[model samples]
Target: MCGGDFMSKNPEEAMDFLSYVADVSRGWDEPTKGEVGKMKSQLNAYNAKAGM
Candidate 1:
């Protein structure tokens, strides 16, 4: 909780938003492995923090 309640305090919402971004990004262009990995890392980190 760095600096308390960052962008999204809701875990489910954050995950949903990330999933949506991934889907939308796919339509825009093919996301590289690094880009996908970054998103995954973010979700995993958030999930861990939220104890999901």
Candidate 2:
């Protein structure tokens, strides 16, 4: 934690990062159904954060 990189300070930024992760994970085949479930959970979480 020497460069303010490990800890997250912005909710929007974190969501953006998680969105990118979810997008890339969409192309993978590992974990099959698990990945989809996790992705959906993340999406719901983001939406709830935005109060949508």
Q: Identify the candidate with maximal lDDT.
A: 1
Model 2: CA > 4 A from native: 1-6, 30-52
**lDDT per residue, candidate 2, 1-52, as tens digits?**
1245525547777677768778888877566688889999999999999999
List model 1 lDDT by residue over 20-51, tens digit each. 77887787777689899999999999999999
> Which residue pairs clash within candidate 2?
none
Largest TM-score belongs to which candidate? 1
Enumerate residue pairs that collide in model 1.
none
CA lDDT scores, all candidates in order: 0.77, 0.75
TM-score (C-alpha, index-matched) for candidate 1: 0.42
RMSD of each: 17.1, 15.1
Cα displacement (Å) at residue 32, model 2 = 14
